[model samples]
Target: MFFKKEKDNFPAFLLTSLVIILGVHIFALLTSLYYILPWFDIAVHGMGGFWAASFIYYLLFYTYRGSVRMPCFIAFVVIVSGTALVGVLWEFFEFAMDIINIPFLGIGLSGKAVLVDTLLDLLMDIAGGSLAGMLLLWLKKNTL
Candidate 1:
């Protein structure tokens, strides 16, 4: 029941990636690099997006009993949409952390900066999702 099929190995890559991301994020927070370096946030968000999309793709493929038959565009839309939703949820989490004065996770931005940062984060999420979707599509096509 844990796995859909016998061939479905553990999601090592996903778990490993999540750990790496969390480690890097913690390091950034401890070193204050996230605050000192603007691009750091963007880079992290991009990676998060890619990871989110990949997770969604894996879940979709894993749940189905047959081979992938969907159109590339539709797959792209689904992955990107899922990633966007994740990004929005993450932003909300961050906002909540800021409101609650949570250490390391809150940026505490105000006014236009908050809006700008959120927009940029969403854009990076989309960009990363797009890249992952394209890569997955290519892999599926070639493997099939």
Candidate 2:
């Protein structure tokens, strides 16, 4: 019943939004749009990071009923690290899928391409996570 709980609505909503975004990406991949559209991967990765961070933000605050007086630096670190961990896990999943020859979502990259792609994805993830972290910190200071 966790999904039915009132306090879980916002996180559920955030996750739903992520599902929609992922659906779009999956569609693009299936249609080979990523091959035609160069920036598609970058856009999806950045948005993934943003949504992942936002979901973490909501999760953290929703679980804490006391005063939301954490230092800005600490909050930023928590958000960034959480988001980065998610991103890394995703990369690992992709690698594992490739090893298992899963045709659905693997990028199917070789040595240099795999390294470059992973690094760029991580960089974009960090960029989006940092933005979310800054916004959350600002909101906590001013509104929460």
Candidate 3:
């Protein structure tokens, strides 16, 4: 009822993204700076989800702005495909940080925990991004 038009205004997406990014930053600070690492899969919960969300928002932004000229299939494929690959690279970065050593302490990069978490993180990312894209597309066709 609040939104008068079928299309969602930019504020809805922008504010949501700002909160998500800020929350993720706080969590990141807690984990790294404060050394408050948790047993729970923090990677998946942290910026990973936000990344996917932002990507989906990107798709929606482009679509709403009338930038998506290519076929829908091609556009979705490109977005999803790139996200899947990016997920893989992210895992590598996290793992790399732990594997190398700069001083007396060696980072804990090579382990099953990181590996599994990375895979799961990517899964969540793909699921989130794909869902967002599809949902926005559906909303564009149906209602806001």
**Which residue ranges in model 2 land beyond 4 Å of their true spot?**
1-9, 67-69
State the local distance difference test value for candidate 2: 0.81
How many residue pairs clash (N, CA or C atoms closer than 3 angstroms) in each of the candidate models, in the order given?
A: 0, 0, 2
TM-scores across all candidates?
A: 0.89, 0.85, 0.60
Candidate 3 displacement at residue 41 in angstroms: 3.3
Pairwise lDDT winner, candidates 1 and 2: 1
Q: Which is better, 1 or 3, measured by lDDT?
A: 1
lDDT of 1 by residue, 26-107 (tens): 9998899988998999999999999899888887676666466678889889999999999999999989999999888898
Error of 3 at 133 (Å): 1.5
Clashing pairs in 3: 98-107, 98-109
**What would the per-residue lDDT of candidate 2 be over residues 24-119, giving only the tens digit for each residue?**
889988988777886788888888888888888876777676345577798789999999999999899989988998886788889998998898
Deviation of model 2 at 140, angstroms: 2.4
Question: Which stretches of model 1 miss by more than 4 angstroms?
Answer: 1-10
What ranking emerges by TM-score with the best candidate at the front?
Answer: 1, 2, 3
Model 3: per-residue Cα lDDT at residue 143? 49
- By TM-score, is 2 or 3 better? 2
